[model samples]
Target: MTALHPPGARERHALVVRGGWDGHQPVETTDAFIPFLEDHGFDVRVEESTAVYADERVMGGIDLIVQVNTMSTIEDEEFAGLQRAVLNGTGMGGWHGGIADSYRNNADYLHMIGGQFAHHASKPPEERTGGQSDNYIPYTVHITELGTTHPITAGVDDFELVTEQYWVLSDEYNDVLATTTQEARPFDAWNRPVTAPAIWIRQWGKGRIFVSAPGHRLEVVQNPSVRTIIERGLLWAAR
Candidate 1:
């Protein structure tokens, strides 16, 4: 529980925009960290729509934006304001589909975030339980050499999770911190194994962007390793 802002530091504001497909449990997931942000000295504000992204006066004062909306549409004006805020140095961060799989039609959003959720490798048909759990595969999240030294991932050891393993489409602009490799099993289509970034950060103008692909639910968000990385990432990304 290290304080992000020391005593005497100016008060900072954090905006949490949450909603969209409920399957991702966006509300619950973001709720898990609001207290953390408050404890760290942020004046936390919660919004249920992406409309707030369009409020320039509000966006301008924000120190950080934690978006938890999944598979939702954003108005062009809203998207523009968000882009402007980040470009001017307001940090942004989120986990799982809340950030990665959001605004599917917005290429600019994808380019800004530096990654998109391509797919979630599923279990074989016989093993499927006929629900979202079908993609709950046990896998390891390997900390890269760079992750070991980055503030967001420093000292966090490689860990395992039984959850949706995201196949992310990302570019070199991302400073990858952690990765997960999808094995080429007999049932899978790809012949060779594919590795996707499980966690990463990017510099967008003066703002910093942090993303973690492992938080598919509240339980996953509460994982010690996952929780720690996200907390540190939030502070590290803040303006």
Candidate 2:
């Protein structure tokens, strides 16, 4: 069967950005997001830039950006440039800890991303010191009321998956697209209940942003439904 985002459709464009620590799986992870655009006709460009910060020209000529950078901090100029690029309507998308957990030490980038990774809403804190892992587990996703009628989640259901299910503390400003009802975790000291944003789309300046809190591994992203979420996310996030 043909890929989801075939390149024969039209002239949609995207930039696949990959760079960061190896443990977070940047190179392989971003590749997972590229073919969807390629299969749908977006002329995709891949930049395996370890120095996306130093090169400076990586974001040039791109209409959309799909970032797979994880647990890495960028210089002010580099981060700001990419933020400006996306804010100017070039589009941006990512999942899990990459965009949300990126630059934990930097507030500007955190503000740009709109949320921080407080903790894995599902996992018990006693299970590990830091909630960082590439484990592939299955879980269900609950669509929210905000943008459920939108094109992105139009066909997606409250489906289950054997993959990472991200629970993010999102900004109230986001146009929430979907969510998951995380069961109450008594193990969590901050404890009450855990229900978090599974996916969200935000508008910045002249551009758009979409984020999904899943895809811890390549296999997780390879799922047809997961692929669909990323594909529609790209189309929706793109200017």
The number of the candidate with the highest TM-score is 1
- By summed lDDT, the worst window of 10 consecutive residues in model 2 runs over 128-137
Model 2 residue 158 lDDT score = 73
* RMSD (CA, Å), each prediction: 1.4, 3.5
lDDT of 2 by residue, 1-239 (tens): 37564355557778777766676677787776666676666778776652453444656556788877777777777777787677666888887676777777678777777766676544444444554443334567778765568899886777777655666777798877777655555554655656788788888787788888876667666667677887788888876
Please tell me which predicted candidate would have the highest lDDT against the true structure. Answer: 1
* TM-scores of all candidate predictions against the true structure: 0.97, 0.82
What are the lDDT figures for the candidates, one per model? Answer: 0.94, 0.71
lDDT tens readout by residue for model 1, 1-239:
66766888888999999998898898899999998998889999999999999999999999999998899999999999999999999999999999999999899999999999998999997999889999999999999999999989999999999999999999998999999999999988899999999999999988999999999999999999999999999989989
Model 1: lDDT equals 0.94
